[model samples]
Target chain A: MGASLLVLMIPILYRIIMGPTGFDRILGVNVIGTKTAVILVIIGTLFDRVDMFVDFAIAYALLNFVGAIVVSRYFNRTVPLQEMEKPKPRRRAKV
Target chain B: MKRTAFILVLLIGLLLAWAARDFPAWGDPHSPASSSAVSSHFIANTGVDTEVPNMVTAVLADYRGFDTMFETVVVFIAGLAVFSILRGGPNRRTRDREFVVDFEPDLIVTNTVRLIVPVIQIFALYVLAHGHVSPGGGFQGGVAMGASFILIALSWDLKTALARFPIERCFTVAALGIVIYAGIGLLSMFLGGEFLDYAHLAKVFPVSPEMARYHAMLGVEIGVGFTVTAIMFALYAGLSTDGRMRDGL
Candidate 1:
């Protein structure tokens, strides 16, 4: 079951790597984060220590949510996605 | 240069992999670490010595407490360095920023955060207090607590978060954490034991030596939690606004 979940994450990984829009990548990452929490629970079940693993899963999920929020908040501004792609012009060094 | 760097990284990775081959299999009883007298002593005596079900916590907060105290100091110093370097500089205009964030806090995000923050905080305290029986302690709890404040900042603005946990108070709280940790150690020393000998805490409290160690670990964890929570928020506040402490991400 854990193996299957990991295999499913490949598509999400592809989206994160290749998605054109920042939002697509963000969503992909969030999806993977949620899946990771499930996988953690599955691992805990396998270990026959559900109580121990549940705490880990909860903490992981919380941090993942916080990370997604931070990213979304960062991109909440008026700047276009394309503008972010362009490299900033370098200023000449003073002699 | 990129090709050379990649080759260098690959070589180092291969070397590390080769080195890792010498390590014993996971959970092997006959492994050097598992068979070592030191580990055997810990595994056998931790329960008898401290009555802490979590040996990791016992080792961290009791057996090698001096190391953990210094670690807390290192965290405090890192926060102080970041604050000192980034704080109170000439403010950059919004136009100069890479991404100009100019918007009101979303009602949905703020409301969700408001609902979740309390739960996260309670969980953090649970992790801190329950370290003796489970796989949690001050650092994890402190980070969770700090993240709650960061969440507040993210959902609203840095100003609102700072208003709740003022920048000056952050450092004060951080310093207070160290004082709490060292004070416990010093108190033990004054009670006729080595520094951080939590067993000596039994003298002041009307508990057995084993119970004293157990309770002192909790107190130590609380001190660590205090430092970590303050520093984590302080780091975010400092880095987000480049230390002007206003208009942060």
Candidate 2:
């Protein structure tokens, strides 16, 4: 089962590399991130250490989720070029 | 330029791949690390010394405890570094007018988060507590706990997340984590054991030395977890808002 999931990651990798839009790339990365968790579990099973590996899988999935969210939120903004030009007042200056 | 970059990447990749051959094969008993008497002693004695089933946890939190303590300190420093370097405080400008965040909270995402946050937090606790018998420890569990908050921020807004965990509270909690770890070490010292010696804790608690180490390990893990979880959220809060606690990305 994990092997098939890993094989499926090849297509996701292709999308991450070749996706036309940034959103497509993000989606591809997220898919691949999730599959990596599954792969970690499979590796754990191979080592006869599923209990230890399950914790890893859970942590990996959590990190993957946070990474996707951070990326999406970053791109969610369209910062105005005009706003970029205006320097806000600097309050933390020292004499 | 893109082609040149790709070629360089492939070159580096192939170099790394070539270098991988020197690494000892997986689980090779004769590997330098595996064959060392130090590791041999650890493998033979961790159960007897610590009464801990998980060798990794026993070695990490007990034997090389000073290293792990410093590692937690490193994590604490990382949180501080992010705050000092990236945090700009909440932008007052964002208060007067609408801050542009190109997306709105989708109902589906927010609702899903509401349902799953409890489950995630509970699982994080399980992972943190179960480290002795399993693969997890403070770092993994802390990241999981922090990730749930990040998810809340992602699904709703930073404001909503902060309502549950304020910025001041973030720093306080982070400090508390380190103190918990160090306190255990200090207590052991006062009890005539070396610093971080869990066996010393047996004097204070009415338990066998072995059981004292077991429980002390759990306490130390929780301390590490606390620091990590706090730092994780604090880093997010700082980086996301550019230090202005308002209107995060």
Which candidate has the highest DockQ of all? 1
Please identify model 1 stretches exceeding 4 Å from their true place.
A78-95, B88-101
- TM-scores, one per candidate: 0.90, 0.84
Report the lDDT tens digits of candidate 2 across residue range B60-112. Answer: 99988899999999999999888877644465234343355555787776787
Residue ranges of candidate 2 with Cα displaced over 4 Å: A59-64, A77-95, B1-22, B87-99, B102-104
Rate residue A67 of model 2 by lDDT. 77
Write one digit per residue (lDDT tens) for candidate 1, span B1-249: 999999999999999999999999998999998999999999999999999999999999999999999999999999999998885445533335543457888889889898889989999999999999999999999999999999999888887998999999999999999999999999999999999998888988999999999999999999999999999999999998776677666
The TM-score measured for candidate 1 stands at 0.90
Candidate 2, residues A1-95: lDDT per residue as tens digits?
88889788888889888877778888887778887888998998898988777877776765565676567566654354456568768766343
Let me know the TM-score candidate 2 reaches against the reference structure.
Answer: 0.84
**Worst 10-residue lDDT window, candidate 2 chain A:** A76-85
